[model samples]
Target: MIQNKGEMTVEEVRLNEGHAFLKGKLQADLLYVGEEDGRIYSLSANLPMEETLNLDGIVNGDKMCLKWEIEDLSIHIIHSRKMNIKAVVTFFASVDELTGVRLPVSLDDETVSVQKKTMRVLSLVIHKKDTMRLKEEITLVSNKPNIAELLWYTTEVRGLDLRPEENSVKAKGELFIFALYTGDDESGTLQWIEHSIPFNGEVECSGCISEMIPNLEAAVINQTLEVKPDADGEERKLQADVVLELDMKLYQEEDHEVIMDVYTPFRQCMPKGRKEILESLLVRNFSRCRIADRIEVKETQGKILQICHSQGKIKIDKIQIVKDGILAEGIVRLKVLYIVENDEMPFYSMEAMLPFSHVVEAKGITENSVYYLHTELEQLSTTMVDSNDIEIRATIGLNVLVIQCSEEMILEKIEEIPLDQEKIRNMPGITVYIMKPGDTLWNIAKKFYTTVDEIIQMNNLDGDEVSSGTPLLLVKKVEE
Candidate 1:
């Protein structure tokens, strides 16, 4: 087989006159002279041999695209006859990676789809060869040298920076890329919790379970052993309230693709940019082409995105803001503390629906402007025990910073460890008072400033059965 050295005159370069893209430097077929030796040549480019063109491991049939040359190749070849191409796209089937050229195709078609593949072994003289033997480098490369010539299925949009609030600041930005996935119902769930229980003197508690058991051994002997003999708990929280502080989160769905005419407006009236991008669909001949449709000069769509990102800020009394870092959109996710006064300490115990914190577009707000007003409150609750000692606690969704406070401050919720025996004994119903004549549970409750229910609870009474001479224990107050 006769091998051809690829070469052609520069006359074939096609010029799309009036093309908006023609404004820049061009590399078209104008330089490929249909020159040929007595034998068939592989391929050649407009570049001189001394130029030493570097092919990025391009294999035959591999898709190639245009990128700005870091240095001017024409300047480097100063003295040589300068050749320029219109920078028109080309398709190749056979390639010479070493020479950076595409071989002629046997078939005839203005637009061709490659069918078969072939490779070759060629040699270049570095300096010398001994005994008529040549050292050859065998590399397989693609004939197609233009990205617009190959078949690509995947498309990417990148470098989309999103600034919800302002510019010149370290605002949040994200690349909302498009995707055409093969399936749906792809989802995941995330969760976390900090649990606590209130405590008072010697209470029983089971150790943390190592594993979940479905059924315990159904035997009397096992039941006794499971009782945990000598488990002797050192009075933990026997009487307590369980609280869980939860943070709810929400995220929008990703991986969706919409189809519309390439000329359709994106982000509403915000320019699908020049409407000329519709022409590039012709160049999309291949997918991986990073070429921005000649119209949207940006690598990807850059516009005002509609983000219903609903992570809202909480409105609280006195707030201490602790910031960590910027969110995906460049907004600051803040940590705020709500201050509670001793007079309002009891209010902290009742949990209210937490706030919805999110990013919002700020208008006319300056560096000195107050961004938002926090309305979240530090929740709390308290009850006077039978003995008049107060037990203050943080209700659900709130944290307890401390047990007793004479002044106002920020507080967090912690497990109420068991109180001292003295404190427990001092609580309202810890001790019982004996009943006297004319003291019905309700009557005695009123006289002693206690509750009828407290009296029944004190004596473990199931009903209103109270004999005049009967003795009963006093529990707590039944207020008017």
Candidate 2:
């Protein structure tokens, strides 16, 4: 009788072969310009002006955050005898290469197999052309401030959008610029002035494929900014030049046959079996979640006033994978700039560090599974209610990817009992035996304790053929 050993677990081996790279460019123009007096202050400054100019650039430094390559970046100020202010920006980009599995695998009732691989898909950048470019002209009429110095200026990317087209990728997003300067107010007292502007635009990526989608975990790799005063402008007018580089990675999920466990139940005596097993890494889940929360300002921070701007940063501290879900622990750091009810300074900056813990739904999570968690701030908004408190709203995005290492095994062979010799020797010698239909020499020899060669020689009569009811001579092997 054939016995079935229930099932055994085992793993298959696979290797990462190579990668494929996608290259493209991102180009746009700045929309915001400052004008003072009869002179026009544009991005390209030509005239001689006495002022201190400051510039800053912001980018992501995490190596494992995403895979991308920046080939070149350039920012130039465009000057026209008629136009007020204009800037040209360009970015050369290349994404990390992705490779799919190419090896062959086999599956059957006795064996189970699975394949692990990585795939890279392009993420197109998208943004509103009008909303991205923010331009405004402000004059401190009360202060009647003279253009003495440009203190500091910085640029950052808040969000990005990508979409696939027929043969190219569509990119859109906004760049946020903040500038701080020292100036004199109406009373001739020295004060700090803050100004913010946003530039938006959309471009079609020529070398990108249309089937790719925005990655759940895309990130900005590097960025550069240029700020200069227009020489011809009489008043303190400033122009900004900006450039940005982005990186995106693609991921794919596949299902494979894996052995859970194994057992066998037919043999009277326990059969000895051998097992074969392997270890492999597998991705269980890849998804993103948005987290929204509020923060309140304390009374000690002074009375309610106007809020200038708010920024949020998220850092992950720990991650735990449990049954059917995953738990994440992190802290949200918030920085706010606002005016106090009776403060001597025009604006006060306050920073708040908040601890947060959240759970994401993921099925089939076990203790043996490993995980990677990445978080980013998507949006931040604040409202002032009274002199003592302000309400803040923040939107955070979380990316979770799970991996599992599994083992599989299969029964190579089984052990069985030996044949009984005494019963075979007890058969009568020279006895007349009736031939049976559907009989073979080997089966007959096994039944009579004789070898197939002995049975063939003894029953010769022609070949090893016997008809039903035919008489045959049977002999039990005598010892020696």
Candidate 3:
């Protein structure tokens, strides 16, 4: 095979005790030159895959968030028409469980005191993994040659902008289609065409609103290009089918009061707490990296006569949190198709692996930070440096999301018991208390076996706040 590309699609996920089962399929497109005709050709195949992952703290009802990519691929040709293909696929997964933290909404006993505080939380509203398909048919103009046989094709989706509305989302983007085919002329020469197809679509999403914060990830997963006949009975029409896989997460800001601490004149209450990490959106950055390199044509590979089409794939190797930014190190695998100075084989393809390193600005990022990074080939071009060398220029777009994580103690429930009779009885009915540095109205009231409202009314205070060393009057409630 001359070159290849691949994508992984996850179909099902089943969670059990501390493990997850995944079923998926891998699609690989292989490009090769014909043994007898010396002409280029393309073939596609799907391989079913199953994997078992050891996921800690996973349960049956927990939601599994999974994503996968083809990390590496290798093909070995056993014969002219037979080959062995092996792919290393990488999967990233996380588990999300919905649980309720129950704080006492209202205590039936009036003597049970509660200290409540309103917390602003960034809650996950919706997590959706969906797909959208785009289809287009185009006819070649008079200037372009009619297709005799389709050899190879590549497609990219770019500038996809999404807008959320009431229960739906609108997406607009352009699909870049590149194809190399043999012409139907007398000489049967090879020809290439590049076209941009604009597309707009809407997806129905339940509980989606414009005000919600959206984090979207999209990729061109599957595609097909077919040659067909035009109205004039010429093979000049091209049909393109593309599938875009989208992963969307929407968040909303909400405020709610949860009991932080509690006490009472009649009982003692203890709050059961669990530690959890709260993720807040820090920054969403779309940046570009420009790559320029020269590739020297070896003597074995024929000299380039004219450049036709160029395409690229980005593979990120590592990501590190550096000072004031994130450092991404990766390689851009570029394929360039050109007409060679040869009579038998007029067209040839060359491949190159160009290494690149870029830093995306993400201030305050650390080792504990969570992030999502995606890269796409925005543009690529080739210029002849000399008879034996070619210059490659490319622009790679980087989409990144840095999430700020914070640990919080969530109160789940409260346990109550009878209060110490000795402690309650020894307290005076009324006393003048001095507010300390860390004192609050609720804290003092709980200490003196009273309520925040009663303390404020008795002290004639404007609000619940008091300065250190300020004297406050406290009164204990007596039984009726």
Ranking by lDDT: 3, 2, 1
Q: Is candidate 1 or candidate 3 better by TM-score?
A: 3
State residue 234's C-alpha deviation in candidate 1, in Å.
6.5
How does each model score on TM-score? Answer: 0.12, 0.45, 0.83
Please give the CA lDDT of all the candidate structures. Answer: 0.22, 0.44, 0.81
lDDT, candidate 3, 1-480, per-residue tens? 567778787788888999999998988888777889777778888999999999988989886777677777888899986889999998888866765444334556666676776766667788887888999997887887789888778888876877778998778988889887888889887678888999998787899999987777787777889998988888989999998877788878767675667676556777788887766667778888998999998777688788777777888889889997889999998888776788676666788999999999998888888888878777777899877899999888888888888777776777877677777778888899998898888878777878888998998999988899999888887432
* Winner of 1 and 2 under TM-score: 2
Worst 10 residues of 3 by lDDT: 98-107
Candidate 1, residues 1-480, lDDT tens digits: the string is: 111112212222222222112122222111111223221112224432111123444443442322121111221222334433222222222222233222222334322211222322122212111111111111111221111111101111112121111111111111111111111123211111112222121111122121211111000000000111122442111111111111111111122122111111011111121111110000000011011111111212222122111111222223332232111111111211111222212011111233232222232323322221211222322333322122333211121111111111111111223324453345565344555665555445443445555566667778767765666665433222
Writing each residue's lDDT as its tens digit, candidate 2 over 282-369 gives: 3434344444445565566566578766666676678887667788888776667666674343445666766777777667767876
- What would the C-alpha RMSD of candidate 3 be, to one decimal place? 3.9
